[model samples]
Structure formats: C-alpha cells, structure tokens
Target chain A: MTEKKTLKRFASVFLASSLIVGALAGCSSSEEGTTTTTSGGSSSGSSDSSEVIKIGANLELSGAVASYGSSIGKGAELAVEEINAAGGIDGKQIELVKVDNKSENSEATNAAIKLATQDKVTAMIAPATSGNVIATAQIANQYKIPTVTASGTAPNVTENEDGSINDYVFRTCFIDPFQGIVAANFATELGAKNVAIYADNSSDYAKGLAASFKQQIEANGGKVVAEEAYVAKDVDFKSTLTNLKSKNPEFIFIPGYYEEVGLIVKQARELGIDVPLMGADGWDSPTLVELAGKDALNNTFITNHYSSQDPEETIQGFVKAFEGKFNESPNAFHALGYDTVYFIADAIKRAGSTDGEAIQKALAETTDLSLITGTFSVDEKHNPVKSATVLEYVDGNQKFNSKVNP
Target chain B: MEWLQQLVNGISLGSIYALIALGYTMVYGIIKLINFAHGDVFMLGAFIGFYAIARWDIGFIPALIISMLLCAIIGVIIERVAYKRLRNATRIAALITAIGVSLLIEYTVIFFRGASPEAYPEVMANKSISIFGASISSQSIMILAVTIVLMILLQFIVHKTKIGKAMRAVSHDADAARLMGINVDNTISATFAIGSALAGAAGVIFGIYYTRIDPLMGVLPGLKAFVAAVLGGIGSIPGAMVGGLVLGVVETIVSAIGYSLWRDAAAFVILILILILKPSGIFGKNAREKV
Candidate 1:
C-alpha cells in the first residue's frame, strides 16, 4: 500500500515538473526576470555612484545559426571585457543579462519584454532574425527602452511604408537591398547572363533578396530561367532541383543562410550541375566549407560586411583578437557584433549619459565611425550607410575579393 | 510540358518515399508497433556516411555500406533496450514509448549537432544529366537504383528464406508461432534490424539529395512513411512501396504545378480522404479483430 502511494506521488510530481518545463520552454523569458506584474507602478532610478547597467542579449545560441550567434556574443563579450578592464563605462559596469532565445520567436519576444520590464534593463541587443527583430522592436518601443540589433538585414527592420524608419530601433548591418544589389552587380560582373533563384519564402530576408536579385538581374539584361521557393526547415530539394533543371540556367543564386545553401550546393553538384553559385552574407561560415566541401564552393561568390582575409588594421586586429580569444576567425555576423558594441559605445560617449533620448539622438547622428565592418555612417533614417565587401572562397578560406559601394 | 515536368518530379520523389516506407512497414509487420525512431535511424545512417567521408575520405560505395551497417546496429540496440521490455505493455503504451524514444534521439542529435542544418558535402550534389528534357543527376539515378535493388532483395528474403517464414508466423500470431518452436523475439529483432537498414539507405539518399541534414529531419518523413505504410495496408510490404511512391509523386506534382505551399498539405489530405473512404488501403488486407 505504501509502495503504491509512493508510486502515485512520484508520478504526480514528475507530471508537474514536465508541465513546468513545457511552460518554461514555451515562455522562457519569465525565468530571466520577466514577471507577470500589473502595469500600475514603475521604479525610479537610484543615485548610486557604482550603478549597474543591466542589458539583455537575446540570440539564437543553439540552432542552425548558432555559430553565427555564438561568435556575435563573443564579440560583444570582448567589448564588455575591454570596457570593464578599462575601469568600466561611466564608472558603472555593464552586466549582460543574457538569454538563449533558441530561434523561437515567441520565446524571443517574451524575453525582450521580460528584459525590458521585469529586469528593467537599461538597453537590449535583441533576437537576431529579421522577423524576431521586427517583433521585438515593437515591444522595446512600447516599453520605451533603447534596443539596437547587430545583424537583422531586412529593410523592414528600419524602414516603414512612408520611407521612414522605426524611431526606437537601429541596426548595424546594411539592409537587404544593399546586399541584393551588391550580389546582382557581382553576378553581372561575372558575365552570368542566365540565373536561377532558390529562396526561403518564410524569411523576410530571403524573400527580399530574391525580389531584389530578380529585379536587378532583369534590369541588367540577365534572364531569370526559373525561381524556386523553399521553407526554412525543409532539407530535401530533389523536387525543387529537378524543377529548376528543366529551365537549365547557367548559375544558381540562393539568398538564405548557410544551412540550406550548403545542402543545395552539395545536392546541385551531385546532380552534375557545376554552375557557379552566389549568395549573400549568410553564407560566410567556415562550416559551409566543411559541410559543402571546398571544391563544391570553389566558384561560389558572396557579398558580405567584412572578410577574414581583410587587410584593414581594425579588421586584422579584430581577426587576431577574435582568433586569440575564440581560436577561430570571426565571420560577418561577428563583425556586426563588434561593430554594434562599438557603435553603441560611441553613442554613449557622445550622449554622455544613459538617458534613452540622448542616446537615440547620438546614435542617429553617427558618422565616420571606423568599425571592423568598415566606416559606418548613420543615415537620416538611422540605417547604416556603408560599403560592403565581395568575398570568394579560395582553397577553403573566405578571401576578400573586392569592395562594392552600392 | 509543365504537366509532364510535374509528373517526372513526382515519380522521382515518390520513389525515395517508397524506399523509406518499406522500412516502416516491415518493422510494424512483426511487432505491430510503429518504429517512430526509424526515421532518425535513417538520419543516423546519413551521418555515418558523412563521417566516413569526413574521417576516412572513403569513396561513395564504402561510405554507403558502412552507413547501412551503423543504422542496423542502432536499430538492434533500440529493440534490445526500449521495445523489448515494452512487449507486454498495452499497445497504446508501446506507441507512446516509441514516440518518447524518437524524441530522445532527435533532441540528443540537437544537443550534439546543434539546431542548424548541416550541408551534405558536394561530391554527390553538383552533377546533373539532362534526359528527356528533364534533368536527372547521377545521385538521383543512384538513389533510384539502390531503392530498386533493396526492394528486390527484400522481396527475395521475405518470400524465399526460413527467417521470412518465421517473420510471417510471428507477425500472424506470436503465441501460435511460439508453439510451433519459432523464436518470436529473435525474429522480431531481425525484422527491426533489416527495416532499420533500409531506413538507413533511404536516409543517406535523402541527405545527399537534399544537401542538408538536421536533428528533426526525420519527423516529417517518418510520419509520411507511416502514412504510406497505412495507405498501402499497414502490414503489407509491397503496398508500403506503392503508397510511398504515390505520396511522393503527388507532393512533387503539387509543388511543380505551382501550388508549392500546399504541396505538403496535399499528402495529408489524400491520406485522410483515403482512410475515411477506404480503410483498407490499396494493398492492405482488411484487419479483423479476433474476438
């Protein structure tokens, strides 16, 4: 009887724990100081000389883009380490209240809100995907907190229908239009007259790149043989490939991340299609070479923020420091991270205070800031106006090919 | 031209699904429990193949065999550890346990491989030959050929061998088969091992053809193969093949004809319509519960 009762109790406890974990998985931000308190009272800032500036870093730390996010986080951490080592920023140490969003939008949005309201973080560097950026930007704006995204490249991340950008949000990376134009011009320069496109229909970034690439290709007198669309999670591409081959294009342009790009390149090659391939910054991972093999990517080209082979002092310094720290060369996304922190630091120094309005004003007026990405200047609408680099893989390493000023 | 193109795409994909469904059907034949983990076993097979290439720089043929052997071992282990102990449990209990085992394998993959999909190396991907205005790659031809050979080998084994009789007997009635001096447990394990090996083969082809592999890669295909198994008649071997091919072809045709978004939805819609109207699939025997 005792054993039966004990077994029943154990089952109930296990069931409760599973339910709690499920709920946590669904709304993970609550554990990160996001509480369910009603919005009647707000706390006032205390006048402490050694004040703590809690900031949130929500990212996809364990998914397909983990390497990108992990490197970005390391870059950000490097900034924090440098700042703190130099006796902190404004005599207040910056504490990163980090949360792994794990690529789930609901959890990301929840984390952003939690960081803003419950943790009452002074600022945030958010949920990295373009969709996550758009979603979290609204919450940050609603709560009146300053948030800057490092690498959400979709135009809608900043721009509104009326050619205005969101006031509260800023991004370090160039918009998709810039990347698309750069890719298109690069393709034209390569003398490719016929091209096929495979795009991720779900992501705003992929759709934007496809539209822009197609428009530019047509504008440049290049024929689009076929356009195929795929969802983010679908790994199989036999049908898409077969359908695409019916048109018989000379080159293929995939404007998604490295995950599908690597697979597409490999499968496309296996099918005896040895056409050159082109992509955007999302293909700048070392894993791409490892996954797709160097030979497969021999003729591939892409437009990126900065390459590991960049000879610029800041970039070389960043590469060395990053390698010394993490033991691997940082990619374009990681460069965005290093630039994001520096950009924010520049704004803080200009603002001379952590006041949100002052920081926003300083950020809007950013100009001639030498970043690892390149020289960045914030436009009137607060988008980064900077030249990007064209990179190609040679002998298994991404090398700087040329700079495009689109 | 478009319709013809759609048909070609569908037939090609359907063949791949048919290969995977055979694994699901054969395992369920003996144990009556869906090997939910079978799809992951296929994924494991692909990874094993990848490892062979990465670590050993092995040629395609050797990589293929090593990958199949790895999957077989994984299947046998799953049987010994999870399914064997649950044989006496209620059917629903076994089904749920299978699901748990499947999730465990998937998450374990995520934990190690991370969430990002890895691209298959290009030795197989970047080659194509145009035939009849349809582009077919050497990889596709290889996938089709391997699947055909596997089907023939399976047919031969199931119809011509003593173990085949043991499998049939156990699947038909475990108690009667035991009375007739057949080792029911061993037959069931052998069935799972073979079924898992086929899944492994399909998985390697899937990874090569898709050019990407992730932890949760198996769920949709696994579910689809299960649906195929039922569509062909739950316990029928050839029926699973037919069902998988039909499902694959229909999905491909749907996408090729420009309803790309609705392509996946079409598979389930057809499965549901078929089940509601004709519970006994095209090749399935009408199952009657013994009172």
Candidate 2:
C-alpha cells in the first residue's frame, strides 16, 4: 500500500508539472509566431495586380458581442455584394476574407495574424469594439495594412495616449469624447441642472465617455449629484440603484454595453427611480427591448452614428437595401459597417491602386468622402469630422430625436 | 429603512446560494466528494426553464416543475456515469473528476447555445411592494418563499422517508449501512436528486429575478455556493443554510456601504476566516475522527 501511494504521488506530480510547462510553452510559442511573422512593410501580403482586391474582415462573429459583430458583417457583405454586382472596384472584384475573432482580445490578435500574414489581403476591417480594434492596431502597423473600424469610438483606438496617432488605424464613427459632450449638451437642453453618472468600470469605452461627460456636464453648469460604477457581467443592481436614488438626480447617464445596461434600466425602473437615463452607441441593439421591457425603456436616449429613421435620401436608400437583403431593418452598427466599406472603397478608388501603401496614403488624405452615415473628411487624428444623431426610446422603438453636429 | 432595503436584496440573493449550497453539503455528506458540477446543474436548470416557457409556451409553475425534474435526472446521471466508479479512488482523484465534469457541462452548453446571453421571458408582472420604507419586488418574495418551502420539504424528506434514513446511515458509515441492508448507491443517488431539485427551483427563481442567463454563469455562483457550504460546515445542512444567508447579507452590506468592488471578493475572505476559526462549520459538531 505504501509503495502504491508513492507511485500515485509521483504520477500526479508529473502530470501537474507537465501541465504548467505546457501552458508556458504554448504562450511563448504564440508570442514568437506573431513576432517573427508580423515583420516588415515590404512583406505586405497582397499583390493588387491580380483579379481580386482581397479585403480581410477581422470581426467578433460568435461570442459575447456576436449580435454587434454579425450585424456589421451582414452590412459589409451587402455593400460588397452591390459593389461586385456593379462591375466591382475598378473591375477587380473585391474578395472579402472574413475571420471571426470570437469577441476576445487574444483571438483578435490571432485573427490579425491570420489575415495580414497568411490571407495576404491588402487592407481589412477591424472588430466592432474599441478594445478588439486596439488589439489589431500594432499588427496593422506592422503589415502596413489600412484597417477601418465600423464603430470603434475610443480615442485610444486611433491615437495613443502619448499623442502619437496610429498611422494605419481609422474609424468611421465619431470618438468617445464627442458622444459624451453631445449627451451632456442634450441633457443641458432638457433643462437638467443635476445629473448622475453610472458607468461600466471595466470598459475603456464606458470609462472614457464617463470622464468626458462629467467634464462637459459640469462645464454646462450642471452639478454631478452622484457617480457610481458597475462592472460588466454584474446582474444585481438593486442595492446600488437604491443608493443612487437617494441622491435624487434629474438625469442618469449609464454609459455601458447593452447586456448590463438593459438590466440596470429594468431594475432602476422597478425601484421607481424614473429619471431619464441616457447611454451611448452601446445601447443600439434590438435585444435591449427584449431584455428591458418596453415600459422600462421609456424616456431613454442614446447618441448613435446614424438612425435608420433619418429621412435623408442617402440614409433611406441604404436602409432599403439592408432590409431587402436581411429581411430586417438595420441598426446603427449595420449602417456603420456599410459606410466603413464605402470609406475604404473610396480610398482604394482614389488611390488608383490596390497596393497597401497607396491605399494607406489615400485613406490619410481622405477629404469630403460621403457615405450614408456621414459625409466628412478625415481629421489629422483619422476620426470623422461629422454629425451624430440622438434617438429616444418610445414604446420599445427608437425614435429619431435630433441631430448634433461637430 | 435604507439599510433594511439592502437586507431585503441580500436575502433574495442569499436564498440562491442556500439552494445550491445544500447540494454540495448533501453530496459531501454521502460520498465525501465536493461535487463541483452542482453550479452547472443550476445553469442547466435555468436553460430548461427558459426553453419551456419561451419556446413551448408553458406556464411559469409547470415550467419550473419541468426544469426541476430534468435537473434532478441530470444530477443522478452525472453521479452514476462520472462519479460512481470513482467512489473507492483517492479523494484527490474524485475531486479532480468533479472539476472535469464542471468544465464539460459548461462547454457543452456553450457549444449548443453560443456565448451571448439570453433574457428570460417575463414570468410575473413587474410590480414592487413597499413595507417599512423598503421596496421588495414580487419576484424577490417568490424566490424567498420557494426557497423556504423547498428547504422545509427537504427537511421532512430527509427525516421521514426510508431513503432519508438510509442516507443518514450511509453518511455515518457506508460499510455499516451495507451491513444494515441499506442500498448505499440508491441512497446516494436520492441525495443528489433532492439536493439538485432544490437547485433547479433556485435556477428558475434566479432567472425571473435577474433576467439574464448565460452558459458560463454557473462558475462564480458555484464557487460562492461552495464557500457557503464550507462556512456552514461542509457536511451540515442547517450550517449551509445559515452560512449562505449570512454571506449574502454581508456582501450586500459591503456594496451598500459604497465598497461595491469588494462584493465578490468578500465571499472568499469569509471562507478563509471560517476555515481558520471554526473548520467544523457553524452547525457541525466537533466530532473526533476514528483512525
């Protein structure tokens, strides 16, 4: 029995040590793979002289953010389909090589490697969220590939904190500070003297918006009555909400994603804290209605890139094409995805070559290029100089409230 | 009054931990194995209830019954298939197997339903009843009531039924139970059934109260429930119940006092303190081990 126990201990220790060593080896190997392969601009993957203009789409197709990622994929697909049918980009058909990042930062890096090194695409579309886009930023620079994001609105997505811009990274939507200021201005217009800010502490997207909103709200002569935070994936908020209710603010700004935001809104209303709650583009999902009952969403507002209900001719035409293809009306994500493709295609057309360097140059020099979401020139920071629309939730549907321009 | 409101919130949440903790305590009593997969059983129960109400159009009560029954069967199957053969193995081996079973069930659910969360269909009217300056949603009241009634039923079943007698006998000594003509395997299976049935009921209440269900939702709650089991004394039922409620209230108080960030971490701290100060748990007797 003693000998058998010794054998068992030895076997278990051996197995445990092997697992630890295996994990460390795996991490180092992947790091080496990225470093070795993501090397030089001269080794930029695509040769645009072929019959196809290869465009890679690194998206979160099947994870926590699947609804946003898949919707953007559909809109991009629609734009590509129309372009292919109408004699392609300069008669060289655009072949989109789509990769699913699974809504993970690590997976986003892997997708960037697979797209930039192996797929040999001239340019690509980054993931929907800011963190995932940032994951691919360094890889984009390494490959000299110009990647445009549909809705990555964080300032760090395009420009680093040290005031150095990501030369190859671009975004179609307005930055986070713009949305925060826009929301503060809207609150001021609503005669809001005091406000509460409920932010998602885990996400840079929410934290960024919260900081800017606080600054602009105080600037607008409004006092911040309360500020609280809840991390993503938190399901209970009654205690926190009850505490906030005691502060008695007129407006509540919950800058978080739809998953937690929906529950917060529902729980807040249940506690009878009926002040008007506002958020940013993260609330632009149809599932928000299903999660937070229609009654709970009353008087809620969100600043978005575009609203399908906007009666502009450019917006209406894109909405019609989107609904006809998918059998459902498109949300702001879809519109942004569609515009991102056009934004890149316009750069490719003006550059007159599918070469990575040529397209990157054209993108940096983009001026007055118009799409369904907006018509604007790329600023020095590669952000769009354009307008944002605010929509109000009424009877479980988004009603276009007003447009704010910057 | 504000403090009272936080207490109400804590109890509703604690009842969930209590329901799940019972399964851990019962299984540990019978087999001396911490069934780590108990939390996933709760997750499965929520999904079962979700499909029954959302897809089959079943009423709330019937759907809850269906979820509980199905989860009970899943618990029994997990025991028979994964745990039965490991009964005589070393304790570490059995514990590792339990952890393996946990990951298997979580990934299997994720395989079928993608990682995106689903909102449970509204079961009850959205209404809050206020008392003594504290507002309690009807759903919270329902969760507390269901938990208490199920716990009472568990007590009665464990004390009154022949299987309950067999379970106590087996927990005392499996060899002695066999010598006394008790079917040890069947008694263990029944313990899993009853414990998992309560967890299933808790799952439905959790869905209705929180309104978001995901495949990996079971991980954190499972660890917390395990902590509750330990705090109550690993093999003591009454200890498990009291431990869960105390932990819940303490977490809520932490958040209410404006330290919401430490809410999740507070559970593990209590667990460590309990192990050092009173390893036998609150309701457990300091019985001497027979070598």
lDDT agreement with native, every candidate = 0.75, 0.85
| Clash pairs for candidate 2 | none
Candidate 1 lDDT:
0.75
Candidate 2 regions exceeding 4 Å error are: A1-56, A60-69, A80-123, A138-143, A349-359
Which window of ten consecutive residues has the lowest lDDT sum in model 2 chain B? B107-116
Q: How much does each candidate deviate at the interface, measured as C-alpha RMSD after superposition?
A: 9.5, 11.0
Supply the DockQ value of model 2: 0.23
lDDT of 1 at B86: 78
- Candidate 2 structure quality by residue, lDDT tens digits, B32-80: 9999989988887888888778877888889889989978887887787
DockQ of 1: 0.26
lDDT, candidate 1, B1-291, per-residue tens: 445545655666777788778888888888888888778777777777666665677777778887777677778767776678679989898888788778777665554444555566645444566766555566667777888899999999998999998998999999999999999989988888888888888877776766677667888888888788888887899999899888988788777665676777888887798789887789878778789
**Native contacts matched by each model:** 0.29, 0.35
Point to the candidate with the largest lDDT.
Answer: 2
TM-score between candidate 1 and the true structure: 0.80
lDDT of 2 by residue, A302-366 (tens): 99989899999989998899889899999888888888888999899999997788998899899
Q: Which parts of model 1 are misplaced by more than 4 Å?
A: A1-66, A77-124, A131-145, A159-165, A191-194, A218-225, A272-274, A324-326, A352-354, B1-15, B48-91, B111-113, B116-137, B173-179, B208-211, B286-291
Q: Ten consecutive residues with minimal summed lDDT in candidate 2 chain A?
A: A32-41
